[model samples]
Target: MRVVLAEDNVLLSSGLKLLLNSQGFEVAAIAADACAFLAAVETHRPDVTIVDVRLPPSFRDEGIRAAAQARRDHPGLPVLVLSQYVEQEYAGRLLADTRGGIGYLLKDRVSRIAEFTDALRRVAGGGTAMDPEVIAQLLARGGDPVEALTAREREVLALMAEGHDNAGIARRLVITDNAVHKHIGNVFLKLGLSAGDSGHRRVRAVLAYLRRYGGNAPDATTPHH
Candidate 1:
């Protein structure tokens, strides 16, 4: 798969390019600044783009802006964003489009090469790939609005945010498929997401959960090597 990479850090970018190349992803373009990042996307129009949350010249949110702009310019383009911090507000913005091919993962995850590549492939295949840290942050914060949900219901919701399907969640929780569906239904009802079609309701439920509990705390797990 062709990939455009946007990262200001030279060492990390080189390492990433090598890693992705070894994994059979063509590094179509590499950009060090926001302008170049946008240019690369328009020029290369790669299969997917991996970008950092910060870039040169002020280094605030240049990469996020580029990602948002790219989506506007090329709708449904797959992109995976990496960040050193959780920055839930940034995550919310990244997920706003929800065009099916998106990812928000902590940079530490790069050390787990297998999982990182899997996430990239998943996003490229039109699926979401959210970091475990992101989910841990949400859970660390109080889920008061969703507190009315039973423990299992909350578990289902969390797993959903982690990009797990009903079957995956069921297996992880060691429960029946029917039980998983029932918990998901209860979650939707408690979260007031039952009004829309199933797909729309699922998005609403996930967004509501994030808006409520995200941006609370640092991830509890040690940064992976």
Candidate 2:
């Protein structure tokens, strides 16, 4: 895979370039600011992009905005945002696009090579990979619809949002695959996502969870596909 990375920190960007290269991913370009980052996206058209939440010029949300703009300009472009904080609002905005091929992970996750690379690949392959911390934060702010879930069902839904499949969720939660399926079914039922719903039911469930944070919610009646 090819990557265009955007991070203001020289040490982190350089280290990431090396790490990605060593992991068999080509580093197409690295940008320190949003302008350069967008330019690189247009220039490299890389398979994926790793962006920081903040960038130069403002350091508030320049990177996130640039990432959103890049996605707008190049629809379905996979993006993985690295942030020092959870920034649930920003995360919600990005995820609201709901095109799949998205990720939001804490900066510290980069040190865990296996996890980071897996997330990168998952996003690149048109899947979601939200940080567990992000998911926890969203879940903590319980409200209508989501509040209907049992504690175990909520746990399963959280893992599903993190790009885990049934087997993976089972392994992580130390539960049986049958039990995982049961919980997921209950999550779908509680969320009002029927089996006949158009998009991947798991994706829709995650989207419903994300809708509580902010951004336009996916049309539950329409097929995400």
Candidate 3:
């Protein structure tokens, strides 16, 4: 797959490029700032883009803004954002798109080559891959009906948000598939998400979790360059 990477840190960007290349992904372009990142996206039209949450000029939310703008210009553009910390607001703003093909992960995950690559591919294929830490924080701070969930049900919901299916969750939690199903059912019920929901139940649940904090997050429409 072709990838356009946006990161201000020279060493990190170079390392990521090499890593992506080694994994059979073409590094189409690299940009250090929001403007340049948008230009690269327009030029390369990469299959996926890896962006840092902070970029040059302001070193604040430029990367998130750039990614959101890119998605606006090119709907359904696959983006995998990397952050030094778990910034829930940023993650929520990005996830707010809800068109799938989104990923938010901590930079530390880069060290886990296999997992990182898997997430990239998942996003590229029009899937969601949220960082576990991000999910945990969202669940922790969420209000009712999320507060109504039991501890185990919360764990199941968190894992579900991380792009894990029932089998995957079962293996991670060392529980039976039936138990995972039961916990997920309870999560859906507690969250008031019904079988008639428009989208995939799992995705709806994750979106519900994000909506708890998304209300306070910055709007995705960033000032154009």
Q: Please name the candidate that would achieve the greatest TM-score relative to the true structure.
A: 2
Error of 3 at 70 (Å): 0.3
* Decreasing TM-score order of the candidates: 2, 3, 1
- After superposition, which runs of candidate 1 have C-alpha atoms over 4 Å from their true positions? 195-204, 208-225
lDDT score of model 1? 0.78
CA lDDT for candidate 3: 0.82
Once superposed on the true structure, which residue ranges of model 2 sit more than 4 Å away at CA?
Answer: 212-225
> What is the per-residue lDDT of model 2 for residues 187-224, given as tens digits with 9 covering 90 to 100?
78877776565555587667865674342222221101
Clash totals for all models, in order? 0, 0, 0
At residue 17, candidate 1 shows an lDDT of 95
RMSD of each: 3.5, 5.4, 6.3
Clashing pairs in 3: none
TM-score-best of 1 and 2: 2
Local error of candidate 1 at residue 211 (angstroms): 4.8
Model 2 error, position 164 (Å) = 0.9
How far is 111's C-alpha from truth in model 3 (Å)?
A: 0.3
- What would the per-residue lDDT of candidate 1 be over residues 1-225, giving only the tens digit for each residue? 999999989999999999999999999999999899889989988899998998889988999989889878998888899999997778888656656678899999999999899889988887787887776565565545665766667667667765667777777888899998888888777766754555534545676656555534223332221
